[model samples]
Target: MAYPWKSWDRALFSQVAGRHWPGAEPVLPRLSRAADHGRLWGAVAAGMAVVGGPEARRAALRGAGSLALASLTVNTVGKGAFRRARPLLEAVPVIRRLRRQPVTSSFPSGHSASAAAFATGAALESAGWGALLAPVAASVAFSRVYTGVHYPSDVLVGCALGVGAAFAVRAVLPPAPGVPRPGPAVPVPELPGGRGLHVVVNAASGPPPLLSPPAARIAAALPLAEVSECTEDDDLAEQLEKAASLAAGQRGALGVCGGDGTVRLAAAVALRHGLPLAVFPGGTRNHFAADLGLRGVEDTAAAVLERRGARVDVAGTTALDGGARGAAEPFLNTFSIGSYPDLVRVRERWSRRVGAWPASVLAAVHVLRTCRPVDIEINGRPRSVWLLFAGNCRYSSVGLAPVRRRDLADGRLDVRIVDGGPYARTRLLGAALTGVLTRSPVYEAAEVRRLRVRVPGEGVHLACDGEVAPAPRELLLDKVPDGLVVYRGRR
Candidate 1:
């Protein structure tokens, strides 16, 4: 069948080349040559990593991924289907012709495809980065025609394909978060001898300290406060709800003497009833408590009595796979997928035998040795990741210990992703042992208000606030600005 568009395509090519200026003749060829084998795009990605901030690094990585997809599609499918021949050599100037031309069909220009893909993908992540790259992408696309390798129609089609591929890739990745608005700061109410206070203690959470008859100690400290204990068979959510109800009726604050998961529950209840929450460092790790600089139950209790506290943002997740039972769960510290769940499982299994710190190290080694990257879609782009973590706020490295969030009210989620590249086990082990996992090349971090994680298969393991849960096929994570009012002793 004769295609009518072919004639018009060739005519357009002829007109573009006929109007080409002499000044561009010297520059276009160099740009075209630089893009050979997609080396220029790789260089751009590397440069962004070295010089750009967190957002820039993320954009660079996404751009590289999109470029790869565009190049593959153009070379394998678009070129093969059209089988169009390159422009005639006699139609171009001798000086403008490439020394070694591409030996593939020329219906769609590969260079143009890659350029458009990178620019479009980067822009979708960060408009500033995209704006910076747009001119460069356009120049590279024009270079193909200026160098007399690809015709105008070929470059045009290739660019269109590239842009389409970028959007298609982004569709699979998690969507970017919205702008955060500062939440209203709620004042902390004083608790004289815990007169209007309610506390729930989960016996099964963390070490013996959290479980060490918390009701007795709490009663001794706050004689007038109501205290509830969750037995092994008791539903934690129910216990928390009951405590919240009591606090609402008594006009008091709700407190949790347990781990991160318990703290998360208390935060949710506090938010729902507009009550302040007191977090006791009763968990083995007590990530949230540590972030708040709370040493133990006594310090938390003292903070409550003094009415000293801060309103902080909370991280919330909605399971897309019907697993959450139609409710968004709040997390106070960090939420993770991939190898992290494995590590936590291993740690729990061996902590009794070898202590918490040693068990953690062993768990790291064990998980790293057997861990494989998870196949996930972020926003809408497919990615294979060894670990993906989102902290409630920005976490800065503090020596050999775990990361600590410096600001709880920043209203952003600190997302860190570790790419599962070749020999991932060895790389991860080395980074962990060297205490440089957070700074490794395989690691990428960004601050976002919202992110979506989707798994191709069912039963994605997720670790939220040190507790494991089976997440549905998709999960939407977002930051709730000043979502919880918590008591913290003045520093």
Candidate 2:
């Protein structure tokens, strides 16, 4: 009972099975057996959890989800749609016959589908880890044909189905930036009539106050809440500190309306006073506020009154020399060294003419053309690095737009280093433009609990949460777990 395509399928299967040399014979069987019933996927997940960072673990989970989908498709639709029988054992060596032959139709190999789906899904999240797993996936798929259980066509079609399933999942739930997922929401005692709320508005920080009018909007939303406004002449840090002190003395929640830098300062003060912090998105990008699901002052006020919120991690840096006085400086977003500060300065200069996003593009071009790598010592090892970025929490380096962390409580820093050597500038620029910076050999990413960096001399410009500061030659960076509680709506 040979089907119309049976001859061609068997010919291909015979070629694959017949070419098995002594070198691969033993290893192929072991690999095939290990991958049985999706065990290989579980192994991959465990390995990633052990060796990979938070993002790697997430990617592995996503891969598992895709594998599940692909398995469902192959077993249900693919098997029933084409009821092809398994390859004849006569053409296969006796030792190569799979001990446990699949009972379902052989038009598609379910094992191959799962393997491809897992690999493709993982690659989409983090290319470095994906590349590491590609060879294993290939071996698993080839084993199906080599074992004489599935025809070559079956394995090929199954692989396609797996890849398709991975893409489908990505479309439905795209990879998130910052924290890939938000932290769990916890209910706080409601603030009756905004009794325990105090807000500070930075008039000079973000866009012109006239367009957004943060103070007026916040007052309208929470009339009972006290608001402090920072004028052009006032020191924003001094004003923020005063507001934080007032809130702390009154045992109230501290709210700050400003850019990421302003929010970061407020967060530090709030942490010191052990008061919950509310963010109003007054910045150009509002990266921190957006990550908290706060769209505007109105949403922030509502969340505060309702007493719904989550605790998030904060990143802090200290001078390695132990010379700088006071507590470690806190940053709510990213901190970078090397050419990044120069790029930011250029972007700011051009932003007035072309706007923020457009200016960034032009600024990158200018910086790449003129910038040179800086020599620094990371963990006592000398290396020339173009840029070193440390994110408060894990961030996705993939995709066109910048990615944030999904879980703020993961308590790990996402550190990325762009290798600086021969043609380093060109390679870095190409990687950034192509959105393959994480995948490029010239770039390296890791999830670390702490990082120590030392420069040869003093007066190094460091960028923290979009604000530049002249820092000393040595620096120590780490995350402060549960550093601040932020208002967030329940999911």
Candidate 3:
């Protein structure tokens, strides 16, 4: 006699066999076959990559990767670990049974694992795509049992493994911008059609290829608003200051069109002038704007005209030593020291020639080869580190370099450090490559309201929102809650 759970599994399988799921007979068998060797998920990933935008491409890549991991695990470890035979098909209807039955162990369904992994991975990247793929994944899983290729328990356990595989993949590279919950709403002047809005567009700012030129888009989106273009020769800070002054004088709002670095400067100017900001994502990798729910000029323009705004935390670094004593700089996104700044510098040098993605790979290689550890005291603890990163708010995911932020006004610093030691770089790289960096001894992360960093000798080169600068030996990093107001509609 089999165990009680095994008996229950057979009973459930028999019940499903007896049920008449209208319109499922033809679909279930064919769907099961379609998912053979993860083919169905591969086709979906290819389609997403071809027709979808950046986010879609990311989803597709992550889905395919997760599917691959799930299939590998199922074949290499899962099947060998349990040699359970395929379910007998005598009770299953002939029409519902697969024409060619699977020959491998049936303790866990490989098809079910692939389906769950792909759906979960894609959804982790983009909920909309995940929602569309979820039903299909479920159907594929159920079809395995309906077609008599796997037991109900087999499919269930396989699905659990698949979802775990998806999360494992996310632990490696992570996903895109998180859901934009733009803090608390704040009152601002309504600038319909850009009226009473002063926008300074960075002429050098370049968005993705799909978008039109930043200047043209800003002009078209905010027609009635005052616009100033900052050329390469023009001092960006001066131009931003001038725009903020104009907007303040007119009791309007200040706007900026640029990347994270440019947005940091604009945020500082806006905060100082007591004015609201309109952020147009007109640069490559607009981290700040994307987190603020402004994906493009149109989004910011609509928010401005509709008088929708929110207040977000602003982080600042105050100099405690050197000539810039007491001087302060504010950053809206991220600040880091050590290998990250080196990586940024190297990437910028080669980005124009090889493109952004390849440039990043090259930068990582270059920095890994040439960069050295820095000695610093983190909150009075002396340590040698390869990197130290602090974000304005707590980022959602964890890894060597986490990207998304769920809350902009959390008023906490998301700090991470990579400890330096013998074979430290190699160990760090291996952990990152294997998707287990979060648990690696070399990596450390924490959330704090403030941090005091002191360098051993001369200050290390630090980067704030991708802009590298020489730092003072001693510095204080703290957040100012609800420090900056920006246009962010609830949409």
Residue 44 CA displacement from its true place in model 1, Å = 53
Predicted candidate 1 versus true structure: per-residue lDDT over 293-346, tens digit per residue: 676677777787777767888899987775553578899888899989889889
Report residue 286 deviation for candidate 2 (angstroms): 0.5
Report clashes for each candidate as comma-separated counts. Answer: 11, 11, 0
- The candidate with the higher lDDT, 1 or 2, is 2
User: In model 3, which runs have C-alpha deviations exceeding 4 angstroms?
Assistant: 1-29, 45-62, 79-108, 122-132, 142-157, 170-185, 231-234, 323-326, 357-371, 379-381, 395-401, 421-450, 457-459
Residue 126 in model 3: lDDT? 94
Best by lDDT: 3
RMSD to truth, every model: 16.5, 14.2, 4.7
Q: What lDDT does each candidate get? A: 0.80, 0.82, 0.88
- Kindly list the per-residue Cα lDDT of model 3 for residues 40-78, writing each as its tens digit: 888898899999987899999999999999999999999
For 140-200, candidate 2 gives per-residue lDDT tens digits of 9988888888888888999999999998788645665442344556555466766767888
Per-model TM-score versus the true fold: 0.59, 0.63, 0.78
Residue 350, model 2: Cα distance from true site in angstroms: 2.6
